[model samples]
Target chain A: MESESGDKYAADLSSIREAQMRISSYIHRTPILTAETLNSISGRKLYFKCECFQKGGAFKFRGACNAVFSLDDSQAAKGVVTHSSGNHAAALALAAQLRGIPAYIVIPRNAPNCKVENVIRYGGQIIWSEANMQSREEVATKVLQDTDAVLIHPYNDRRVISGQGSISLELLEQAPNLDTIVVPISGGGLISGVALAAKSINPSIRVFAAEPKGADDAAQSKEAGKIIKLSQTNTIADGLRASLGDLTWPVVRDLVDDIITVEDKEIVEAMRLCYEILKIAVEPSGAIGLAAILSNNFKQDPISKDCRHIGIIISGGNVDLSVLWDSLNK
Target chain B: MESESGDKYAADLSSIREAQMRISSYIHRTPILTAETLNSISGRKLYFKCECFQKGGAFKFRGACNAVFSLDDSQAAKGVVTHSSGNHAAALALAAQLRGIPAYIVIPRNAPNCKVENVIRYGGQIIWSEANMQSREEVATKVLQDTDAVLIHPYNDRRVISGQGSISLELLEQAPNLDTIVVPISGGGLISGVALAAKSINPSIRVFAAEPKGADDAAQSKEAGKIIKLSQTNTIADGLRASLGDLTWPVVRDLVDDIITVEDKEIVEAMRLCYEILKIAVEPSGAIGLAAILSNNFKQDPISKDCRHIGIIISGGNVDLSVLWDSLNK
Candidate 1:
């Protein structure tokens, strides 16, 4: 499964398996947690894949570690670069730090202070850009040219997709009887990998994408039978504001069974539930899977209505207390 | 290992092993979690026994489950009663609900709304008393006389101590190489049970009790080699305000290594660390173990200065968000 750089949709079970083996020494095999209270709340037995406990406080570390370590010595010596104002930035920084290589992080000017601090704490070289996708990409491109460093696209790279797919490899074996998996959709790297590996291992396992209604591009794309870009997006789940990438979109369009959208308020409530009942701290993006399970969209869906055992990938837990307090207060 | 009704300190390794077997079906064998960031922060390898993920969102459930299930069918039909305004009350209610028996919880009038809600959710019959020990005990005595229900002392009973000791049994097996265990001190049920079981399994393992400076009665008692009662106590860790019971005092005097007292600010900081780094929601009482590990009292201790592997029992995760928010803002 050594995919060519140009192959956007090359990630499969073999690639995911390889990624797992490669990153096994670096990443944690996070525990699966269950709450009876949550089970009764959803009327379905739910198993939470606690990626929130992963290194860098998100599942992004798995992909980042795999990509950084997969590099040959020559490329590794040249270092790596990425433009991310979220978990991926910190994760890439940490992964590079572990490999004793420099990380060039291009962050948006308005990115949360806590996230920026994480990059600095991990020894990443900061490169500021205007708070726009264009500005971020332009800055990243300049950094790449100047430093002669390898660019690791957060969710769009084939290496990253296969790396994130490792989650499914561990999860399926942990909870072998899972009838379905609910994943939070951002750039779709997480869901792309999850769907590919889970379906490959168990063809009947339903894969549903959980999206914030404010950032409903994935839902629109699903309905339109193609990738639909949004002009504007709004969501409290900051990690979920990204549009689906070309590599991830094809997988979502083909493999993802359905897309369920939940409002920001629903996502907040899910976050609170995760804290109070499950005793697990989860960022809003990580809690969207629980929100989707409790949403009417999933409850009324004819195909998945009777799925007994459900697995929710809690994607990350890297939010600021002030931000969380504001959302909970609202 | 079975003790008579009047026995208060009959808990031994056999009793703890029996309790583990009896309650195995009802309680969770909580996972051991580790964080590299935390390890570096404290300059030691730390394994966290996540009792916060227990059935009632605390380790209290283990004892409550054991106490409730150890009764004969006739005694179970008579139900159980306890006077507690903390995790123990809710734990008892939930355990009783699971066993299909009535639970009479005598809560102080000033108990937190969230804790009261938990008792109500578990269908415990609430008997409100004045916010004082005398009133709580008097009301509990009346309830026992009227309903013919057995009284389950929160920490002073043999069954509860042995039940809590199951934690050490499981922890010793999970992290077999741990040379030290740090436990928070309240009424000393948790630490008392932990010390007994941990020392019995490995005589060389050191057991340290972590206490809040505001409620340093445990430290004073250890110094005086006798139980010491505080006229008043003040700490944000509402759970650790209780003094050691007569049954627990002897064990803390003999088997416990030392008592480390930390400030409320330290506990809050540890709570923040638990949420920020470990991604675990731990109450102030639960975070005290980490606080002690980071405190100068433990770090500078001559006896335990060189201990490598340490186990921390995170006692509970039942604090209100508003309470947590206020503490963090401070």
Candidate 2:
């Protein structure tokens, strides 16, 4: 796909570097944990960058902080608005509150109570929307126009992509010689940033994007040599269920080496492994990279030997306990 | 008990210090995690010493390494023997193997597969016994006699206590002004070592032994002024079910400031909070110290202001997933 059209697949990573500079201090340099047990089992080294311990319980804070804090004084006074399942809502709320700005979050009515409470606790105004893409987008657009508030899309924003890229910058700095990095892809903000950060540092570094097969829009898009919309997205990893957004799509299309798909069952197994062996509580989405690695999904399509020092990004830890409790009970 | 006998708990601490000097290369000085969330909720700065990330999956490695390396030329040839539910079993096996010594582990047949597999993988020979205290002890004794192996009791041995003492030594060194500490007590090795180390550094540093009410043998013995046995011990905390051992009770009865008992439900709740909030997976036994603090089970009921900087020893992270799966299921 890249060979057919030069520069078509490349991301505008210069903007992402600027985003990193903007929100450097607001978020944590979340630690990377290399799994000895996993390494031993696979006969290969495995480094896990744990973003599950991120502020507001996710890497969403990076993008949110960047988006909110980058606003002009007039915009800050006018407030900001966004729609999210949960993490992004809380992240944006905290981000806005820190800058002494009002945050108007449009959350799905069926969102988890803990998440809704987190947003409210952080002093964000909540607007309940129907739990569907059409309703959420429509309500967010209406709210944006009604109040003239700045709309911060969760992804599909150059600023958000740049903010999320900071994770890769830190990971590569910590494990500079890493050969391959596998990350869970949602709407492409994180992967776009990561792929750019890694490739920019060393062109040899292979980037693998992990997504649930049910939500394999990015993988399909990459194969089809352009964006391909999916009518249906089914996944336990709520974070990775979305199709790639417009701004994110071009970046992911050009930069990401490969978009890999895995079954949700593999993600569950990986989550359990993280809980059992790694002694870390990670959400299903957070384990997608691990799921890809451990499920032997990569073995059939082997990573090059230069990429022997593999790193996988664990995206977030805003896990729903009821689902985990149910799985544990079973 | 100490008043009548005029005998205070004293560890052969010189042995411990010497072991610390020798085994410094083998063990990790696990980091202490401080929590703003916990401090706010508990009204005290809680320093959690995470040993879950320790090699051999727990603080058992410290004791195991001390015991194995302390062996004379003759005993090293004969190898070492121990009976344990799991953590110590694997620790001793790995520690012994590292030194080219064989490990004979007598394990209850009912022990979880994860632990048994860890022990086996660490090159230990497992001698399965019936799932009863009598059978476990009897099988271990027979194995020791048959093999002429050195018996490294999980907690009763002097060297084992000394090894566990290093955790407190490190904690105190890391946070010097801490006025009080909470140590989870099982066979009492961890708390015994902790009490000795804390008192030696600063006699004013109050040390509390946090024991599960289900297996309140430590609490019972503290009141009885002698070692007391449990008729039936049932707790999700497999780590805290044992009574204070021979070497531990004397030390615990005297040097320790107080003994506090928390319930199984409290332990479970504390585990959940640690897993959820701290993004750390803690076994129920490891969560007892936090449980005690959260429940306000203290002498003054509130952790004293003098004990403003409180240290908690999370002794191990060798969690069994099946058990956790069952627990979280409930």
In the range A100-130, model 2's lDDT, one tens digit per residue, is: 9888999988777767877887789999899
Against the unseen true structure, what C-alpha lDDT does each candidate score? 0.89, 0.80
Model 2 ranges with Cα > 4 A deviation: A1-26, A110-114, A302-304, A323-330, B1-31, B72-74, B109-113, B169-179, B198-204, B299-303, B320-330
Highest TM-score among the candidates is held by which one? Answer: 1
- Cα error, residue A210 of model 1, in Å, equals 0.6
TM-score of chain A of each: 0.95, 0.92
Candidate 2 C-alpha error for residue B38, in Å? 2.9
The fraction of reference A/B contacts recovered in model 2 reads: 0.38
What shift in Å separates residue B164 of candidate 1 from its native position after superposition?
0.6
lDDT of 1 by residue, B180-297 (tens): 9999998988887888889888989999999999989999988886789998888888888887898888788777888899998888889888998889988889999999999988
Write the residue-wise lDDT of candidate 1 on A1-330 in tens digits. 222344446598888999999999999999999999899999999999999999989999999998999999999999999998679999999999999999999999877777788789889999999988899999999999999999999899888999999999999899999999999998999999999899889988999999999999999998997788887788888888888888898888878889999988888889888999889889889999999999998888997666799999999998788643444333
Tens-place lDDT per residue, model 2, B26-134, is: 8867766664557778888888887876776688889889889988889898999999989899999989988999899999987767778889878999999988789
Query: RMSDs, each prediction?
Result: 3.4, 3.9
Q: For model 2, how many clashes? A: 4
DockQ of 2: 0.36
